[model samples]
Target: MKIAVIGAGSWGTALSTVLADNNHDVVLWTRREEQAREINEERSNYKYLPGFTVPESIRATDSFAECVENTHVILLVVPTKAIRETVQRLLPFIGEDTTLIHASKGIEPGTSKRISEMIEEELGDKKVQSIVVLSGPSHAEEVCKRKPTTVTVSSETEEAAERVQELFMNEQFRVYTNHDLIGVEIGGALKNIIALGIGMNDGLGYGDNAKAALMTRGLAEIARLGVKLGANPLTFKGLSGLGDLIVTCTSQHSRNWRAGFKLGTGYELEDVLEEMGMVVEGVRTTKAVHELAKRLQVDMPITEALYDVLFNGKKPPEAAKQLMGRVRKNEEELASLFLGTGDSDRS
Candidate 1:
């Protein structure tokens, strides 16, 4: 198989290594010519994956035409904000029969579109075979080390999903197929918000009891919004939902959690972002989910609180206080909302 990976970030490079290990011819695309030269000559991506070796078999390129020429699959791993521009630039290079798979996670802020939706809208009249999403708890750092990592591939077409499952599966990496595309994407995207909240809690010197409460309630919030958007209620219990939430909130590898930890410790948002030097997706996602929840009349208290902290100059301590002081409600009643069988009242 010939595969073109559309980003050279940590996740993109990690996935390219996987494809090369599977003996597939892989071409990695980056905007910087210097990065491409380094990957092809020095065989290292020092800026993103320091100390990690780029497979000699996986070539690197800055030209879209060179990257996608005769490729069987185009795996998009760019940030959600760049999806539209990246698709537009790569549209002419995409083969008619090529499969389109995206590993990016995040909802668009104003448009509230998923990454797959943004790609399809940009493709317009271009005839592509399939649009699939790869998402779950797997982090790029662990994946690069060939650690045991399991993720879900989802698409409306069962055949497409199964084909992707076969393409990425290996002894070190496990792949599962799910028919619930919406649930998988939503679960994968929204979990970052909860991870931010939990990171803030930890930064504030809170214990495991608080972290457990936030994670459990965060799963409920994700399911509630997902069900309202036509996703399967049971999908939230799968790898993309609870599994992803747990990993993102608890692991130090999570950029969102790290970003939140900084915020909780009294670092300004701009300074933190500049210091991290990477995209902390949860900040952008909090804004999008906050707007979407309001438009859909879904109650997402945690998202709202995080939005205030990220955008409205609200202090993290105050946000935590507000979340803790919200009107109490029955846990079963909240679960009912996840099934789409109850009123929207948060109380």
Candidate 2:
């Protein structure tokens, strides 16, 4: 099958390499003309995936028409903030039969809408036939080198999701299918926020116990917001949810965690972001999750506390203290929205 990856960043390039390795005809489209040239010429993207050459089967193009036209699948790997803008630009070139899979994993800040929502909104009249979302714990740095990893492919239509399963799932890369788009998408988007909090805890010299607590509470908060938004609460335990949270929150490979670690160590948000030289989806995602919680009246303490640190000028260590010092309430009380906890409010 022919595939077009719409972004030229790390994940995009890595995915393009995988498709090319599978012997599929792949076209990687980039907004930057120089980056496009680098992919086809240098066979490597130094800014994103360093020291690895992209497969020769993958062609690079600066023109959307050259990328999307006649492709069987178009993978959207732009950052969360760039999703809508990027998809809008692809409209004139996207054919109806093309299946779109968004690898981006964050909600829109003001809209609180998932990337799929933005895709459908952008492709309004065109009404693309199939849409799937690909997400998991896999990071580009590892995935590019062909590390064994697993992820989920979800679509409203089972057939559409399975179509994606055929395109990319392999021995090294395992794919699971789910009909719950909301659950998977929500899991992917919100886990980054928790990873940021985990980084803060580590940077402040917190121990494994603290990190474990953050992961647990972060899962609860993620489930609360996800359920409030119509996702299956059980999905939180699946690959996109719990699996992603574990990898991002604990792995040194995570960019969000590294950024949070810097923030915890006294660097400003801007400085950390600049030093990282890549998109930190969690920072923007915090705003979106905060807005969603407010709009839905969902009580996500960890999310709320992290939001205060990121946007409200609250210190990261102070945020951790605030979380611990909050009026101890029953976990079952708030989780009542999703899991029917039999535990009492005796905390």
Candidate 3:
């Protein structure tokens, strides 16, 4: 199959390598003509995936039309902030036969819509045949090296999810299928918020006991809001949920965790972001989640605190103190605080 991977970032490049390795015709789209020339002439994207050479079979293009033209599948891997504009740019070339798969993680600001929602709003149901989201704990750097990785592909259409699962599944790369689109997306996106919180805790010189407590409580909050938003509660225990949270919070490869670490270690958010030279998705995600929690009346203290630290000039120490000083309650009460203890709430 001919595959077009939009956004030649670390994640996009890594997946393009995998597809090329699988012997499929792969085209990677990059905004910079220099990067495209480098990928084609030098077989490397040193800025994002240093020391790793791209496969010769994977072609790189700077033109959006050339990337999507005659492709069987379109993999959207751009940042959340760019999804709308990217989709609009691709709309002219996208056909009804092409399958749309998004691997980007994060809710839209203000609207708080999921990536799928954004795609449908722009392309409409007729422009694209299927929409699938590929998500999990896998990081782009490791994935590029062909490390053993597992991730989930989800869509409302089971056939679409399975089709995507077949496209990427291999010995070194494993894929699972889930019909719960809401659960998979929520788990994949919101875990960044908890990861930022964990990074902040570590940066503040906190011990494992405190970090562990924050992770546990963070899962509860994530599960609560996910369930409230019509996701299956058990999805939080899967790769996109707890697995993603653990890896993102602990791994140095995580941009979000690294950004939070810098912030916790006495640097301002802007300075930390400038130093990273990459998008710290958790910063934007925290803002969207904070607003969503308030609008939906969901209790996400960690998300709220992280938002204050990132946007409202609240210090990490003060945010930690605020989290620690919240009202005490039993596990059931805590669950009720998020899920609402009523028959109507048991959806």
Candidate 4:
């Protein structure tokens, strides 16, 4: 199959390698012509995946038309903020019968729309056979090295989900299919926000107990919001939810965690972003989730605190204290919090 991977970032390049390893003809799309030339000429994308040699079969192109033209699948892996613009630009080239897959994990700011929702809105008259989401705890640095990795693929249709599962499955790379697109997407996007919070915890010289607490309570809030948005509560325990959260919060490879780590150490958000050299999704996701929580009336204390720190100039230490000082709850109230029973105190 001919596959087009839109956005040649670390994750996109890694997936392109996986498809190329599967012996599929892959076209990697990047905005920079120079990066395309480098991939074709050097067989290496040093900016995103340095020291990793791209497969000879996996080629790069700057032309959106060339990328999507005659492709069997289109993988959207751009940043959350760029999803609308990228899809709008690619709509002209996208075929009516193509399958759309997005591996990007983020919620749109202001609008608070998921990536797939954004895609459907931007698709216009172009009707696709299916829309799939590929997500998990796997990091690009490990994936590019062919390290053992497992991820879940989800879609509205079983056949379409299975097709995507077959497309990327291999010995080193494993894929699972799920029917809950809402659960999968919500898990993938919201975990980044928690990861950022834990990163801030680590930056503030906090210990494991604090991080473990944050992880536990953070997941409670994630499921709270996800359930309010119609996702299955059990999905939070799966690879995309709990799994992605662990990896993103613990690993140095995570840009979101790294960004939060910098912020935790007293650096401003803008300075942290400028130094990262790549998009740290959690910052924007924090804002989006905060707003969504308010609009939906979901109790997301961690998200709210992170938003305060990121956008409203709340210092990290103060934010931590504020979170720790919230009204205590009994086990029943805690159950209500995670279970979304609406019996807990809303104050």
Best by TM-score: 1
Residues 1-347, candidate 3: write the lDDT tens digits.
89999999999999888788788999999999999999999999999999999999999999988899887699999999999999898887877787999999999999999999999998865577788999999998888888999999999899999999999999889999888899899988988988888888888899899989888888888888888888877677888888888888889899888887778898999899888898878888889988998898887788888999999999999999998898875666434533445321221
Please report, as a residue range, the 10-residue window in candidate 1 with the lowest summed lDDT: 338-347
- The better-scoring model by TM-score among 3 and 4 is 4
Give the lDDT ranking, best first.
Answer: 1, 4, 3, 2
Predicted candidate 2 versus true structure: per-residue lDDT over 2-53, tens digit per residue: 8888899889988887777677899888888999888888888999888988
Question: Which sections of candidate 4 miss by over 4 Å?
Answer: 331-347
What's the CA error at residue 102 for candidate 1, in Å? 0.1
lDDT of 4: 0.89
Candidate 1 global TM-score: 0.97
TM-score of 4: 0.96
Off by over 4 Å in 1: 337-347
Candidate 4 per-residue lDDT over residues 232-334, each given as its tens digit:
7777888988888889889999998888889899999999989888999888888888888888888888999999999999999999999989997554544
TM-score for each of the candidates: 0.97, 0.95, 0.95, 0.96
Greater TM-score among 2 and 3 belongs to 3
RMSD of each: 1.3, 2.2, 2.3, 1.7
lDDT winner, 3 or 4 = 4
lDDT of all predictions, in order shown?
A: 0.91, 0.85, 0.87, 0.89
Clashing pairs in 2: none
